[model samples]
Target: MMTRSRLMLAATFLLLSAPLAAAQDGEPEVDCENAQVQIEMNICADRDYQAADGELNAAYKAAMAAAREMDEQAGEMGEHYVGAADALKRAQRAWIGYRDGQCELAGFEARGGSMEPMLVSGCLADLTRKRTAELKAVSAISGN
Candidate 1:
């Protein structure tokens, strides 16, 4: 027979361990840049970046839907899988906003230049590539 004190200690240990285990299995960090690029870079890169973002968003949605379906069928195992999928989706959305804002800022330097479009597009491309890596990392981790 276990003592009351031992039972209480065991319960506390389980509680603490649950969160620690969950944390250990948590999502990986997504990296983005804050470097300054020339105006021509911004103008030239924006559109391609935006297009890539759109593609990522679509893929994210598809993955999310699949996760939801798995969750529904999983009965009990669904929670963890679905939760990770949701997290990845949310991260992708945040990245999109970050990409747009960064490209916009990059265009500021070329406000009156003939090369503004080229600069902005270039900025977009650079940021998009970074964002793509982030999305790919998450997808890999999530096994999506």
Candidate 2:
């Protein structure tokens, strides 16, 4: 039983590490600015995208809060006015779809290859940053 348990543990380790071994087969240090391998580049790009996405989420939340404030003001006017919050929610949903489709197209050149993820992630990061700026601009314009 002891020998069998050790054998199973060894097998499990190999199975779990196969992909990691293949990924870092000959790769060097994974530095974002000086990434030397495809995997490192992809990892850096994914990190950038994730960071951008987080910022975008924060901006969206702030924008949504501002929109709701506008809606509140309109409601206080006791008139049938358009809802800023509703419009913002609809536009944000549409923007997310557009960003995803556009980034997918951007990665078409490297489709099904190791570079596809990097390209897609880079595009996502760029668009997300731009969208965050746009949301901030809208909030500023709305005096919020």
Q: RMSD of each candidate?
A: 22.9, 6.9
* lDDT of the candidates, in the order given: 0.62, 0.88
Error of 2 at 11 (Å): 18
Candidate 1: tens digits of C-alpha lDDT, residues 1-144: 999999999999998687457647972221224313443234324445667667766656655665555566564764554465566567767876887788678778867776667666777677766766665555454466
**Per-prediction count of colliding residue pairs?**
23, 0
Best by lDDT: 2
Candidate 2, overall lDDT?
0.88
> Model 1: which ten-residue window has the lowest total lDDT?
27-36
Q: Please give each candidate's TM-score.
A: 0.49, 0.78
